[model samples]
Target: MTAVSQMKCACDSCLCIVSPNEQAVQKDGKYYCSDACASGHSNGEGCGHTGCDCN
Candidate 1:
């Protein structure tokens, strides 16, 4: 099978795309764009990527 090189952040509201094997934050088998998203934004933080407002 072909490997996945990129995908949308697993966060429900995130707009950033990430490589699952690269700079992605893995949580419960899902790939997120940042630590904030990986933690469910419990700290009122966002991924901080340009154009993404997920928090």
Candidate 2:
């Protein structure tokens, strides 16, 4: 298989793709597309991404 260089955001409800070459956020050994997701909330209470309600 091809070498994997990117991955989906670690947030359970997030749909963002993360790449080591971008500004993706890193937390607890997982990668997130933003600080909110990395902090466990894409927004203040949940993943701010549209349609995602991860908390």
Candidate 3:
């Protein structure tokens, strides 16, 4: 699927804000400020859906 560049946080992690130009190509359309945050969630490091990064 295409990347989502302008969506708000609806996931468990809502602390970090989504940048205007930043985007994440997640299966569930999850949005994060950076890859590190997304990766963290996937590894169960931070707050997010299960397997969040791989979405």
Name the top TM-score candidate: 1
Q: Show model 3 residue runs off by greater than 4 Å.
A: 1-14, 19-27, 41-55
Candidate 3, 1-55: lDDT as tens digits: 9764566554454554454454553434565555545564565455444444422
What is the TM-score of each predicted model, taking all chains together?
Answer: 0.93, 0.66, 0.32
Superior candidate under TM-score, 1 versus 2: 1
RMSD of each: 0.7, 3.0, 8.3
State the lDDT of candidate 1 residue by residue for 1-55, as single tens digits: 9999999999999999999989999989999999999999999988888888788
TM-score of 2: 0.66
Q: Compared to the true structure, candidate 3 yields what TM-score?
A: 0.32
Model 3: residue 3 alpha-carbon error in angstroms: 16
Give the worst 10-residue stretch by lDDT in candidate 3.
Answer: 46-55
lDDT at residue 44 of model 2 (Cα atoms): 65
lDDT of each: 0.92, 0.75, 0.50
Model 1 TM-score (2 dp): 0.93
Screening candidate 2 with a backbone cut-off below 3 angstroms (N, C-alpha, C), the clashing residue pairs are 36-41
User: Candidates 1 and 3: which is better by TM-score?
Assistant: 1
Candidate 3: Cα lDDT at 38: 54
Candidate order by TM-score, highest to lowest?
Answer: 1, 2, 3
